[model samples]
Target: MSSLDILIFIAYGLVILLVGNFLHRSKEKENSSSNYFFASNSLPWYLIGTSIIAANISAEQFIGMSGSGYAIGLGIATYEWIAALILIVVAKYFLPILIKNEIYTMPQFMAYRYDNRIKTILAVFWIALFVLVNITSILYLGALTIKILLDIPLIWAIVGLAVFTLLYSVFNGLKAIASTDIIQVFFLVSGGLMTTYLALNATSDGNGIIEGFKIIANEAPEKLHMIIKSSDPNFTYLPGWRAIFGGIWIAGIYYFGANQYIIQKALGAKNLREAQRGMAFAGFLKVLIPLIVVVPGIAAFVLDAKIDTPDGAYPWLLNTFIPSGFKGFIFAALIAAIVSSLSAIINSTSTIFTMDIYKNFFHKTASEKQLVKTGRLSGVLAMIIAASVAPLLGRVEQAFQFIQEFTGMLSPGITAIFILGLFWKKTTSNAAFFGIIISLPASIFLKFVFPAMPFLDKMLCAFLFTSFFMVVWSLLEGRMKTYPKAINVDKRMFKTDRVFNMVSIGIFIMLLALYIVFW
Candidate 1:
């Protein structure tokens, strides 16, 4: 790497740390649980929107997404596009309930709908998931990607990202995270687009964007196809359209709507209105991610990038496609993305642990100051656990698959509880409680005993079984004592304000155009 490149990378890292520390220091005394955990419920729709997308679409999207596209053409886009549709459901239906109830974490919602026991159990489950799946898998994969590109040691990268994230989350809390995310997101988008454009130009050899497509069309026609054939090695093509539409759709809804890491940003909304707008904003962002992450892989294939493993496509491009000085900036952006995601997890994990577990179960009368302090302590502790465990995740071949395969187990169980708990007033707490428990064994059976079925199919079976049992138990044993009184729905919350909608509409149109152009 050139001296200029190294300078750029250093500049990027320094800038992020400075900005994050600045935010943390600025808000030190605003250290209430709401401020630390939810940005004092003051984030506008735009910040909430960008932060959610940035948090969810970290190195996993940068690394694993292109790999999936390389391995399976556009078939992997099911994750992004399906999530777009699910965001609509969440914004329209679920956001109101969560915002109205003032849920600090996903488990807090469980406590409200069911009981403290279920809340504590789910909180512990979530904390474990964060360390095992999120901090370990996502952080490890992200660090590995950086290590490969920059020739830094993987362990150092993990520690660097973890410590940087821990500093802000431990001291400043979610306000710092959400605020820094506003800046980090700009780099994430700019860096992704920069790499994509350069890759396309290199593939076309200055022939222009049109020739990039021609090169791809002539060189590897299979890479351009959206539909996968049964013989496709990348993903299973069996079980017909049911797997694609029904099974995948159900999973997508569960993931985007109920997943803690993704939805926690929205849960911290300033109000019902901001939360709804934030969901719409994130939905629009998801639509553009394919353009940045997937399009580059197509360019890589056309460029004949050493494609032994699809996972290598992204890192290879980062090394060869970008110029040196700019490479540092992009590297900085990647680190920023990693840090942003890590801080979000640390914050939410602390929230769940402190409120749902520590206070509710361990210290019933803990003061507000004590709760906030405990949250900070939990954040630090969670960071230590995540950093320690992250090294184990370095072996994951594809970041996306590792996340989905593991989180799929927990997501479905939680989704069932939330869906029935929120929408069905008659859903007895007992039923919701048992419903989540039963899903585990059923999912385990399907995963270990019957690998022949697509994982989605197994999830569907488990979900249906749990849903069936919940309904039967609700009817036979008893109903909820009373329909929980409805929280006032803010009409202003559901309405899309003018400022974000204008840009969101443009992105939506662009997304539609891409679908048509690629279709």
Candidate 2:
């Protein structure tokens, strides 16, 4: 990279810091717990939407998913495209119940539906997961990209990213995170597309974007197929038919619906309409993510780029093809993805700890000011812990699969419990608790005893087992203990806004067309 490239990168970092601090200062009151945690419930639909995408599309997508695209072809894009469909379902069916309840975190919702014990258990689990798995994986992957592209040391890269996140986000909380995400998303999308365009241009010998696409289509047609065949080696990971109809929904609902970090953005919206609209907007953007993140990997393959590991594809493209000044802009985009996700997880971790555990148990009478302080402290501690653990993930062969395997083991049970709790009036607290307990053993059994099962199939089996257990246990417990009254959510609350309904239809149609074209 030229000196001009280094200067551009430095300037990008400074601009983000300035923008985040400016947003933090713009908020009138900073002491209120609600304002600190929920961005004062003032974010509009556009900010909420862009923030959701920014938070979700981190190093994981750029590094991990692009790696999958390099190794597995366009079949890897199923995750992103299908998520566009899931986002619509979640926006329509899930967000309404959450907004009606007015909860701060998913665990808090669990408490409202079940008991404080359940809430506390899950809260601790999530806090640990956020630090250990989510933050650590992101930091590791981001550092790997930096090391590959710019020859930066892994530890310094991790520290630089962590310090940048803390400087802009820790004190001001979600307001800074959400507000900066608007700008972050712009850089993320623009840089991602620029990389894709440049890569495609290189592949087609400077024939331009459209002709480049045609060249890739004709030269490497296999990479454009969206569906993996059962006979294909990649089927074990994707499991064509099953991916569309089975375990993907379990994982998707858990992430989009019950995950605290993802849902917190929706919770911060000014109204249900805004939240729903924001989510629909996110769904639409999800459709475009593959174009930016996945296509470049395919282009790398078509150009016959020499990459030893799949994760090297994106960085290989940047270092080889992107010019100096433009390289800095793309590097800024990568940093934007990393920082936005880190700030989000940090803010959500603090929100869960402060509201669910600290306030509920340790300091039941804590004032708003005290709670806000605890939140800041929690964010800092979580960041430190995650940074410490990030370097350890260097030993993992595939950082993305390492995350998915462990997270998949737990998602089935959590999804079963949440879905049952929401819809099944007969579901008892004890049943929910035991159902969660059974899922872990079930997942382990499937993993070791039936080693041939696909990971998604294992999730499906565990989900079915847990769901059945919850129903049976709930019925059996009813004979001995009194069941709590069912949650009284008004049916009318599920109604979709007219604009959201139309937009959702358009997204679904687009997804259908993409699948049919690629299939």
Top candidate (TM-score): 2
Ten residues in sequence with the least summed lDDT for candidate 2? 480-489
lDDT of 1 by residue, 23-62 (tens): 7644345557767777777887888889888788777888
Q: Which stretches of candidate 2 lie over 4 Å from their true place?
A: 25-28, 396-404, 479-482
The digit string of per-residue lDDT tens for model 2 on 88-168 reads 888887888878877769898889989977898899989988998999888889988888777889999899889989999
TM-score of each: 0.90, 0.97
State the C-alpha lDDT per candidate: 0.75, 0.87
